[model samples]
Target: MTILAELPTPAPTRAAAPVARPSFAARIRRAAPPYLYLAPALVLLVVWTYRPLAQAVRLSFHTWNLLPTSPITEVGLANYERLLSTPDLGASVWRTVLMVLGILPFSLVIPVVVGLVAARVRGRIYQAMIFAPMLVAPVAAAAVWQWLLDPGAGAVNRVLGVRANWLHDTDLALLTIIVVTGWHIVGFAVLVVSAGLSGINPDYADAAAMDGASRGRITRWITLPLLSPTMAFLVLMTVLLSAQWTFPLIDTLTQGGPSDATTNIYYLLWDYGFHSYDAGLGAAAGVIFFVGFGLIAVGVVALSDRVSHHDD
Candidate 1:
C-alpha cells in the first residue's frame, strides 16, 4: 500500500481557469489620470516654447524688416550665409568666449567655495548678505554701477587715486561688463550651490574623518566628489548664460559701445533684430545659437553623468 501510494496515480480531469483581463475602457480609465495630470504643462510648453521655436525656424528662411506692412520675402539660406560671412559675427563670438571664461570664477569657483563654507554656518544674515546682489534688478544694478564706474568723479577712481575710463575704454569696457555681470549673478549661484551642498550626506565626510583622514583629504576625496554634480551644473549654467547675464548691463551701460567691445552673441542677435531691423538675420542667428548651445548642453549633461557621484 505504501509503494502504490508513492507511485504516480491518474487524477480527475479539470478545465483550466480563464485569465481575467481588464476591458479597454478600464485600461483607458487607469491611464487617463497621468496624461490628464500632465496636460497643462504639455499645453503650456507647446504654446510658449515649441510654438515660438517653430515660428523662429520658419522665419529664418525668409527676409523681413519686422514691419507689419512689409511683406516677408523668402530668401532660403541667404540670411545665414550673410550672417556667417560678416566680420562682426567672429568678433562677437570671441568676446562671448571671454565672457564665459571671466564669469566662471565668480559663478562656479567662488560659489562652490563659499557655498561649502556657508552650508556649515548658522545664520540667515550671512545668507542674506551673500544673496543680496541677486535681488537687485539688472537695470537698477546697471544704473548704480554706471555711477560707481564713471571715469572722473566715480568712487572707484577716487579710491584708486587714478582717473581711468572704465566704460569708454575698449580694453576695460568688456572686463568691466564681466565684473558687473559676475557680481549680479554670483549671489544666485552661491544660493544654488549652498542648496546643493545641503543635499549631500555628511556621513561620508565624518566617516572619512574617523578613519584618520585630514580635513583637506576629507574635503577633496569625500565632499568634492559628492559635490561634483552641483559644480557641473554651475559650469553648464555659467557657460551657457554668461552672455545673457551681461545683456541688460551691456544694453543699459555700454549699448555695445567702445567699438562693440561688450557685444556678445545675445546682444548681437538683439542688435540685428531691433537696432538694424533685420528680422530674418536675427532669426537665423537665433536658430544657429539655439542649435549650437543645445549641442553643448547635451555634452555637458553627458559628461556630468559620467563624472558626478550620487549618494544613491
Candidate 2:
C-alpha cells in the first residue's frame, strides 16, 4: 500500500487573486455631480446671507454713524462695553422677558387647550371659525385691535363700562400690546397645536377611557405626554418671536413709548441703526441679539427633542 500511494505526490500551487481596487477617477466621477449640483446654492448662500453677516461683524468693531463718508475708527470692544453699561438696557431686556412670559400663557398654553377642544368638535365649520384669525395679516390684525382698544370709544371700554386710555399710560400700554399682539400670533400656535393633536393616535385615548380614565386624567397622563413634542415646539417659537412681535403695533400705536416701556431689542436696534444713526453699536447689538436668540432657540430645540424622546 505504501509503495503505490507514496509513488508520487505532486504539490499544486494557486495564484493569489488580483486585488479588486476601485479606480480613483471612477469614485470621483460618482461623487462630483452632487457637489457640482450644490455649487449654485453654496455660492448664493455665501453671496447673499454670509456676505452681509461678514460685513455686519466687521462694522461692529468700528465707530460709524452709518454715513458712507464717516471715518471708520476701530474702538475694539468699546461698543459692546457701552451697551452693557447703558442704564436702560437691563430694563429693556426685562421688558422683552415680560413679553415672553405674558405672551406664552395666552399664545401657547390657552390655544393648545382650545385646539384640543376644537379637534373634538364634529364639524370643520367651528374649526374654521376658530382658525379664521390665522388668515388675517399681522399688520391688519394689529390695526383691527388698535381700533378695538381705542380707550375713548372702543369695544373693550364700552363693554367694561370703563373709560381709560389703553395705549397712553405706561402700565396699560404694554398690556395693550400683549393683548393685541396675542390676537394675530396666537392663531398660528393654535393651528400648529391643532395639527399636532390631530396627528396623535386615538387609540391612546380609547385605551385610557377603557381603563376608566377621566377626561382630565387622560389628558394629563396620556394625551399630554404624546403631545409633548408639539407643545415644546410651540413654546420654543413663542419664546424666540416674542421680542420682535410687538414691532408693528409698537411702531404704529405707541412708538416704543409711553416711557420706553415697550422698547424691546428690535426697537432698540432700529433706534440705534436707523434713528440714532449709530451703525456700529446697532450692528454690535444685532450680533448680540442674533447670538443670544440663536442659543435660546437651539436650547429649546435640544431640550424639546430630549424631553420628547425621554417620554417615548
Candidate 3:
C-alpha cells in the first residue's frame, strides 16, 4: 500500500521511416512521354532549318555554284571580303532602311487608326473588308498590283490620270514595292490590333470617362498603354521581317530591278544564290544577315519589354 505506483513505462517511439527518392530510371520513365512528343519537331528542325543553316555557314568558306557538277573550292573568307567590298551593299542597306520606314506608316500608323475606328464602329463587314487583303496570296497580290501599277491600261494610272511606270522607274519602283507590301500587311496589322483592343478591359475606359477624361486623353493614357504590348509586337514584326514580307512583291513585280532600288538584303541574297549562281557569296550574305538581324531582333524585344506596359 505504501509502494508508489510504478511509473508507466514509456512506450517506445517508432522512428519515422525515411521517404525514398525515385530511381533515376523511374524519373526518366516519367519524362519519356514529353520528350518523345518533342522528338519529331526537334528532328524536323535539325533536318530542315539547322542543317541548312550549318551548310550555309560551311559553304560561306568555299566557292560553289550550287551545281552538282561544280566542286566546292575553299575560299577562306573571300566571299565575306567580296561582300564587304561591294559598293552596292551600302546602298542596298540604305534602301532597305528606307523601305522599312516607308512601310511603317501604312503598316503601323494607318493600321492602328483603322483598328481604332473599327473597334468603335464594331462593324464585322468593314473589318472583313479591311482584312481581305491579308488573305490574298502574296504572289497573287503582287501579280494583281503589277497590273494595277502598270503605266499603260492600269487602274491606278487610269484613276490618277498619270502615266508613271510605278514598278519600272528607279525612283518609283521601291516606293511602289513598299506600297504593295504595306497594303498586304496593313490588313493583318489591323486584325491584330483589333483583337488586342477587344481583349482590353472596358472598365478602364469607363473609369476614365467617369473621371471626366476626354476621349483623346483616355486613349492616350489608358487605351494605348494597355495596347502597348501588341503595338510593340507589331513593330518588331514589321521591322525584322520586312524584307521577307517585301520579297515576293519585289520578285514578282520588280525582280530587284529598276536599278536595284527595291533590292533588300533578302533579295540580294537570293540574287547571289540563284540568279548569279554565287553560292559562297549568297551564303556569306545569309550568314551576315542572319547574325545582324538576330542581334537586331534581340534588341527590339529587349526594348519592347522595357517600353511596353504590361499592367492592366
What are the lDDT figures for the candidates, one per model?
0.87, 0.80, 0.86
Candidate 1 C-alpha lDDT tens digits along 207-238? 88888999889878888888887888888888
- Tell me which residue pairs clash in candidate 1: none
The weakest ten consecutive residues by lDDT in model 1 span 1-10
What lDDT does candidate 3 reach at residue 245? 92
1 or 3, greater by lDDT: 1
Reference-based lDDT, residue 24, model 1:
87
**Candidate 3, run of 10 with poorest lDDT:** 1-10
lDDT of candidate 2?
A: 0.80
The candidate that achieves the highest TM-score relative to the unseen native structure: 3
Which is the better candidate, 2 or 3, if ranked by lDDT?
A: 3
**Compared with the true structure, what per-residue lDDT tens digits does model 2 show for residues 1-312?**
111113565765646634886588976886698799999999999999989888888888889987789799998998888888986567778888888888997777887788768767775776576667767766787778778888877998999999888888888988888887787677677777777787788888998899898999988887788888777877787788887777877888888898897888888877887888888888888888888998987787778768872233
Of models 1 and 2, which has the larger lDDT?
A: 1
Candidate number with the higher TM-score (2 or 3): 3
Predicted candidate 3: what Cα RMSD to the true structure? 13.4
Q: Once model 2 is optimally superposed onto the true structure by TM-score, how far is the C-alpha of residue 271 displaced, in angstroms?
A: 1.2
